[model samples]
Target: MLNGGPASDDHERLLLAIEAAGLDLWENDLVAGKATLPATRTFRELGYSREEVGDTLAFWLEIIHPDDRPAIENALVAYRDGRSDNYRAEFRLRARSGEWVWYANYGKVMSGSVETGLNRFIGVTFNINERKHREEELARINRLLSAQNQQLDQMNAHLEMLSGTDPLTGLFNRRAMNECLHRLTRSAECEAGVLFVDLDDFKKTNDIYGHDIGDILLCQVAQRLQSCISADDMIARFGGDEFVVLIHGRGEGGVRTILEAACERILNILGQPYVIGDLLLNACGSIGVACFPTHGTTVESLTKRADIALYRAKRQGRSLYRFFDSGMELDLYNRDSLEKALRAALKTRQLELRFQLQVDRNLRPIGAEALLRWHHPVRGLIGAMEFLPDAVASGLVHDIDNLVLENACATLGKWQHDPELRGLSLSVNITARAFDSPSIAPAILALLAKFGVPPEKLCLEITEQLETRSFVTANTAITHLREQGVRIALDDCGTGFSSLESLKSLSFDQVKIDGVFIRDINTNTVSQAIVAGLIGICRAMGLQVLAECVETPDQMEYLLEAGVDGFQGYLFGMPLPCAVLEAGVRDAPQSQRG
Candidate 1:
């Protein structure tokens, strides 16, 4: 038999459901001041028995979290005092087996002695501990993500600074230069000059002391450059021995004085021997200056003009400075046009060569130097001096060398039977690119074999600048040629890299004193001293000495006294074609010929 009251049956069913759902249902008889509760359904789930029923509210209250018990009691007291009609709270409770769990309790309060069955308290409690733990874990991950983001920001800033800096020199690089130039252009400031400085024959430093020492020397140069420029000015390394200085000051005289002082200091500092490990060496720099507003209005225009001035300064003899002018641009454009034409000419065979006689001290034609002449259909005879530099700069000299070598060998075969020219030699000036060819030495040997000419009847003249690359392969090639009985001469020795060490290291058969120094030997004590020193070194090394640009008898007499073994200039004879030279040798009186 069962009680059939509707409200009591509904209440019993609700209690049974709460117990089955792993919750403990509690009821307080306020009039009796007693409390009763079912055994926790969670107890069965955790391998415990339902016989462990609670007798009073204190039994359950004892299992409430210690910190939350006082708040729960206070809230209960407020509800009992009629201060609140409903109660809701979240707090910690001990579940079966003494594990802590979070519980949410919500209920409606009923006043005492109600007549209707509806006047009864009701509430529910739920386990929410797993959801609370997941929330805490998500909060920790968010904090970690914030920390990573902050570190990334710092790293990005550092990378930006490093990108604009030259790693080796520790100065601003060309990329930084572009940014700074734009800023300067937008400013109202006037009178800024861009000086492009290049270390003269820097390749020689690398050859002599190795690239490690060259790197140290470049760092020292950067430090010196920083000291030369004012705080308001900027200096950036424009890649490999080239640096551009931006000076923000007024007055041409002041600029010149500052530039000269800077140049003199740089030369003087670098002139001192650089001591690396056990070796000591020296180097110098050439500066080309182009003043803003005076040279051009834009950075590109000014830099291009400065480069032209730099080229002219290097060509005229390095370790000096030159200012840019409008003529440099005109000359540059003309050369550019000529270079395009030259490239086309090589393909069309419009280029040709004519030989010039090389006379000995006795006025006998011992050799004929192969001189290049261009017979452009529209431009007539384009001289070697006019287009040779353009060819070299444009990297077309290799084509010209092959063309000339093939022609010269064929011409030598024709002259092989001539009695006066049978034993004579042919000298050719070798360019830097020509030596880079793996076939240059072999080509010359093949040419000699084809012509049935002796190796001693061929001479190769190279500038001292070409000797800067101490590449073992290049050295091996040159050594192989010299072993084959070819004579090598270092041309323009006095004004370029003419150090006693360089000469001894390269071991050339001849040293040609540059004509500029020889031209003023009688009047310039400095020129006389340099030539004497070089001649003395040449003689000591068993290398023959040749003086060039002898236009006066007094100059010839001075060079003769300076121990030069040979002279070649207008004073003796100009460079004449091979036919005229042979006729002069054949038709001249025997006294004049000898």
Candidate 2:
């Protein structure tokens, strides 16, 4: 209140500025050992009145948040000891309303030393609560985003796993398998091997039992295959009835033994009966093995070589295993060459039908079986054993069958007027592929009509293996041919699957005993018994029985005693050209006539 002088005017101006800024001023008098707040407006804003302003430092610290008290005390001590020239701190203080407000406190030591202690300190405080609230909100948002990003990372990892897996079997897919093969080839410590497994005749199961049962069978097969392998081995479904197994950490010598053992194990497991719904089904698999840096060095090469080996297994007969060899490549080349040549042979008339005479029990000629012979221009004469498999593999067996049927019917037509060859029956072998054709019966009937040959003079021979597939169509074909007066014979009986079942189900006029049983009939009791049993079965089924490969006199005598109605073998005559058979028939003695 009072001075009109310049110093008083400056003090008044400063007080007015502090009030306008809403700041509270405080001071500590070290000499007097006391602290004071001259204006209490800042404290009052926190619900503390002017009467509540404390005179001591301890009383002032009591209002501070317990977590903030130590920092403010430390700052005051640092300024007083001359370690710091200013006292600055930001902390929370409690209000009378039980709320907390952030305060930024700043002060400086006016007079003090290490020897005398602090003489005075002056400070001011301002509210900074709004800024602190904004900072805390930003920190909370950052934490939530971090948590979300972690969950997203986990989801992405699961999606990646799903992409590389087969959904039905839970095995790795081809893409994942290729990646694994690449990784194996890149490594140098151990050699790797690949086994290509194909389930035998899986498509037949699908056709007979429906796709649902087929799918269940595939899943069961996957489980069985998994059990056959070790934990370190990798297996993958290469799509439809095919699987690939990757073998690791084996040397050349051990790899073959290991692969063979694994293949045998897999075969045994797969061969066990599978029960789907109420039905039990039997299945088997064929495995082809190829090794790293041996059969091939790359994924493509190894897989291709393994596939080639698989083809060889199926060709040799299903439900077996084969290793990839250098010779297999030559075999493939030869097969391809043979397929091309056989196709050309059919087109160029290089294929011929030779006739082998089938004689009655009295050794009189009753019929002739037409055999296909391939006369390659470069390779020379090739029998059915040499080129027939290639023909089947190349999808040309049906065409070859057509040619043979056409030529046989034409030959029979020419012999119709010959006294010695009249009423002689001609039997033509039919391939399984021909049975798959819906027009087979009509085609053969049309050929017989075109050549003016009687239906009773022609016979069709099919192997026992035809029973293994969908036989409904084949049964229909057989019935149609029989209705037209053509006879059906089950060829190579007792050498293939379910011969008796085939005879019981299909309409067959005759059953020719395979050469295997006849080859050792005289020396082996088992062969004699098997032949006798087959003959009895055929007689009971009302089917004619013929014994093939009757070479020795003992074989013929034993077959004659066994009541075989006809015989066909080298003992009678070798397969001859049409002119030779005609000459032999005309020149034969009268006693030889049937």
Candidate 3:
């Protein structure tokens, strides 16, 4: 215990204290490469004898565990060289039980030898396996926590995607579009265009085919709209049957040009026929465009203007696009006022029907076309074609068609006793929207029965637009109505998107050659030829050909020679009130006037 003397009483007490604390102490001689091990209870704890494990540092280094050997060696070297006040290291050691036990070694210079300076060191080895095991458990728990946090982050990202995406179309929803628009408007020198596209007559598709097909159509339209813009642009399903496109145009006039091109592409692409299952669907879109900084700076203002322009597009005629103009705001106000007035007209019975005489080639009155006229108290009289499109957009055309049917039945009933008018067929114009309603046929049948008028005397004129929009519904309505002895006429034939294909698919009793051809029939050889071809086709198909807008005597003479079965237009008679027509039906080729 002492360097130069035998163990003193105090030294013996300290050695007893160190042994009592279960500290295994040892000493190393660097000069001779020898080590001494104290006779501590480690010999028993390791289940080894002093003779089995010799007092050699090489043996301890061999069993100290390969990972901890370097650090333990470094600590001993530092203390021996006086580079550190003390040397300590924690490491693992293989016990006699073939398991690793954690231990800490601490050392200090016991003395310098005469042969070499600082040649000796002494240290204590203590078990630290329990503490190390606790640390390892804490580390494992931290790793688990870190993995959970990463999973939580990924889940949050997925939730955000679902919230922003449309469930059916997979495009961004309105919330996402609004956020994007806000960011777009705030961008520096923001140059962009917003196109608000609403599908024309989409509700008819839903009503006729069911909502499932309608959803598929919406998705198909979304794909088409996506094709119309570049990757820099965004197309989102803004609402039901409506999509919003945000295009980034980089320059001054470039925005307007890009917007126009995009809108045109949208109309053309979306207007393409969709073949779903066995059904071939024709869907079209009306686009309203507003350019950033030109229309307005804010997102709300720009979207509002775009919407206003969209209203104009649908009203002017769907399947087209309109750019927002300052004049549109006034037009919108006027349209709103007109919508109110039209509704009031329906309620107050200001809506009335006039009769345009449809006669045979011999100038004998054969039938009358029921023309819709609004006898506004202030604006005098307005024709149906002038305000009917706007009325359709305002959701009032269906009501108007119903009223027309009712009035036509009433007028036909009044003509029952007159010898001249009793034989007349009453042609009533039905709107495309009315064909979408399932009640149209039943209502017509009911009205005819109620008024004691024969269904054979009622001719329903349906435009080619109706045939092209949804031939399924048109054919269904036409078949059902025709089967009940109600005659169906293809109105304005060869003047719309419908082709000869429409003629082959739809069944009709009559085909009215559009007025456009008749307008120039006297001098325009091309018009004359088209009218002749149409008449020949109708004759071949067993459909009676009626020439509309026959204004001049030459036109009427030409149509009669061309084998036109019936004639209508200003030449025979202008549209007159049904009351005046009921007064005496004398508007004939004999008089050339109403």
Please provide TM-scores, in order, for all candidate models, with all chains considered together. 0.70, 0.65, 0.67
Q: Score each candidate by Cα lDDT.
A: 0.72, 0.85, 0.83
Residue range 1-594, candidate 2, lDDT tens digits: 456988898988998898788677877786775775443666777887655766655556777899997898898777666688688888998888989988888987677766876677787888889999988898898888889889889988988897788888999989899999988877766676799999987877886678989999999999999998888899999899999999774545677787888889988899999998898988889988898878888889999999999989888888999999988889899888777877778889999988999999878889899998888788777788777777887878888888889999999999887878986899998886587667889999999999899998998998427644547768988899999999999988887457766876789999999999999998899888889988998989899999988898999998988899999999988999989987887777889886
Residue lDDT tens for model 3, 109-203: 67875356766778787777889999999999999999999998999999899889999999999989999999988887768989999998788
Model 1 ranges with Cα > 4 A deviation: 1-102, 106-122, 189-195, 204-211, 230-235, 246-272, 288-309, 322-325, 358-365, 392-403, 413-421, 431-443, 446-452, 462-480, 489-594
**Which is better, 1 or 3, measured by lDDT?**
3
Ranking by TM-score: 1, 3, 2
In candidate 3, which residue pairs get closer than 3 Å at backbone N, Cα or C atoms, i.e. clash?
none
Clashes of 1: 0
lDDT of 3 at 69: 81
Model with the higher TM-score, candidate 2 or 3: 3
Q: In terms of lDDT, which candidate is strongest? A: 2
